[model samples]
Target: MNLKTFLRGIHLREEKELAEKSAIRRVLPEGEMVYPLSQHIGAPAKPVVAPGDRVLMGQQIAEPDGMISAGICSSVSGTVKKIEPRMTVMGETRDAIVIENDGQYTPAEGFGAKRDYKSLSPDEIRTIIRDAGIVGMGGAGFPTAVKLTPKNPESIDTVIINGAECEPYLTSDHRLMLERPDELIEGLRVMLRLFPKAKGVIGIENNKPDAIKLLSEKLSGDPQISVQPLKTKYPQGGERMLIHAVTGRDIHSKMLPADAGCIVQNVATAIAVYQAVCCSTPLITRVMTVSGDGVNTPCNLEVYVGVSHQKVLEAAGGLNCEPEKLISGGPMMGTALYTLDVPVQKTSASILAFAHDPVAANPSTPCIHCGRCVSVCPVHLVPQMMQVAADFDDFERFEKLHGMECIECGCCTAACPAHRTLTQSFKYGKASVNRLRREAKAAAAKD
Candidate 1:
């Protein structure tokens, strides 16, 4: 089989052996659960329950505040203790719902019973997904309902299911693909119902041959879907890269997958869609990987949405030693945590703890113009030039150079011999450009 791949991505040592073969285990919270309202990439959900109100497991505690937002559901049977600001994995405070677990584990009404998905119309399927509060489970956290209801649904020709599991040390998606291939396919079919002309493609990196074989064997004789193996590389699961690799379609920076006659969904998100449509289940629990050199035991766990990271660490058998760094997702793009008190959200995929410092203590030096950053950049952006523009506070030059096109994948930084923070500089440069644009717009409005 000829494995397809995008150009210009670095290959890192895949450290997924610790949890890749481990089956998903359940982790229940022993104390109060924290549900942050602004977990997804839109306006925060509006809290519908108040302090002291009883909420059953899978009950909606908050409703979508806007079209782009998703609803918030309780992952445990409990009473609303309070609704206030709480620290999150992003190292910022946001409004969160504190629920005191009653330990009953009672299921909410209209949940767990499987339904006939074939009888439901496309509109009905989309409605169920929206009400279930499903989002992109691959960590993007964009509302899935909005993604499914594209403006030109009929024009869509392909639906790509991302199963690459490209990030090192993260095997949650890998385990899901191996154990729940049926549900994943069913979810893809469910999405296909929304786009009648679209065929489904399951893209997996060649590193996971088991998943590829299982999905291929199960999908045999199915004309609408096929399994495509991708070359093993970091960020192979990126939306644009995956689309280009699988369909030979290029998604410009300002355009969406819909513009390319495609729609990409994560493997776990596809399963979530299947559950929401067939089981009437809400997006309350997710499978995540807990692994690193610092961990005493590395495993894939199915955890509730509001459980704390500290509890998860304990469930993973605590740390082998004092952790020098804690990250909320995979090391390449995941955020470093300031505190373990932050709760898991719907998009949480992995929690990594490292005993040895992941960063080098050596100070950054001047770029030697080796052009490694330019060579390895998946998006073809010049990280070195962007850094220079940012250092000079030249937002105009940064914007003109298309600094916003940077995906912040850290590949340039990883390939940098000078250990310069190329990705970080581009991030700051983009923020500065956006700020300047907003200021100019405000001034024009005032005029």
Candidate 2:
């Protein structure tokens, strides 16, 4: 098989062996579950259920506030204990719905029935997905229904299913591919139906040969879909990177996948789409990998969205030792957690606990003028220069250098021999640039 890959991504110690072999196990929370309303990138969902209201599993507890937002559903059947601000995985407090579990997983009315998807129109499919509160399960948390209804739907000619699972120690998508290939393929078909001229492609990292082979064999008879094995590299699962690897299309900084005539969906998101359309199921539970040196037994667990991190760790047999640090996703790009009381949101892919700090204890030093950061930047940006601009508060130079193009993948920081926090600096600079833009817009409006 020909191995395809994007340009300039670093290869790190995969460390996937910790949980890659473990099959996804279902773990139910024994305590209250907290569902944050602002799980996705858009406006927070508006709460429809108040304190004392009973909600069944898959019931809509919150509705989308705008076209950019996604609805929020109850993952377990129970009475709403409270609708108040709660801590989330991102280390911030947000409005969340707390449900006291009744121990009975009762399905909501109009759920649990399979429908003939072929009979449904594209609009109907989009509506079902929107109502189900589905988003990009791959961690971006972009509303899936909004992505399917692009302005120029006719221009989309291909749909790419990302099975790269490139983030180290995260095996949730890999396990899904190996265990539920048929459902994933069905989901891909459902996505293709939204764009009449589109064909489907599944891009898997060459590292997961079993998934590639299984999906290829399962999709053999289908003419509309094919599988391609991508080179194993960090951030290869990124939308633009995967798009380039599969279709050889370059999406400029301000452009989207649709601009290149493609729509990329994560492998797990595909399964969620299938469930939403076929089984009348809403986005509730998701498969998440909990692993690292600090874990007693690292494994992939099918976790409900609102479960607490502490509950998840306990279910994984509790921590084996004192954790030096806890991260929400992969080490490279995942957010560090300040507390274990935070609830898992829709985009929580993995919860990593390390006994020792993964980074070297050495202090960050001055840039050695090495071009390593430039060499490994997948987006072709000069990290050293970007960091310099950010340091001096040179917003003009930063904007001119396309600092916003940085995907925050941490490749530059990893490649920096001097241990500069290039990615972190870029993140700060991007925020500053964005604030300036918003100020300018506001001034223009005032005039």
Task: Give the whole-model CA lDDT for all candidates, comma-separated.
Answer: 0.92, 0.92
Q: How many steric overlaps does candidate 1 have?
A: 0
Candidate 1 matches the true fold with a TM-score of: 0.99
Q: Assess the local accuracy of residue 57 in candidate 2 as a C-alpha lDDT between 0 and 100.
A: 93
| Lowest lDDT 10-residue stretch of candidate 2 | 355-364
The residue-by-residue lDDT of candidate 1 on 281-367, one tens digit each, is 999999999999999999999999999999998999998998888999999999898788889999999999998764756568999
The TM-score of predicted model 2 comes to 0.98
For residues 204-319, what per-residue lDDT tens digits would candidate 2 score against the true structure?
A: 99889999888888888888999999999989999999999999999977898999999999988999999999999999989999999999999999999898989988889989
RMSD of each: 0.9, 1.0
Residue pairs with colliding backbones in model 2 are none
Per-candidate TM-scores read: 0.99, 0.98
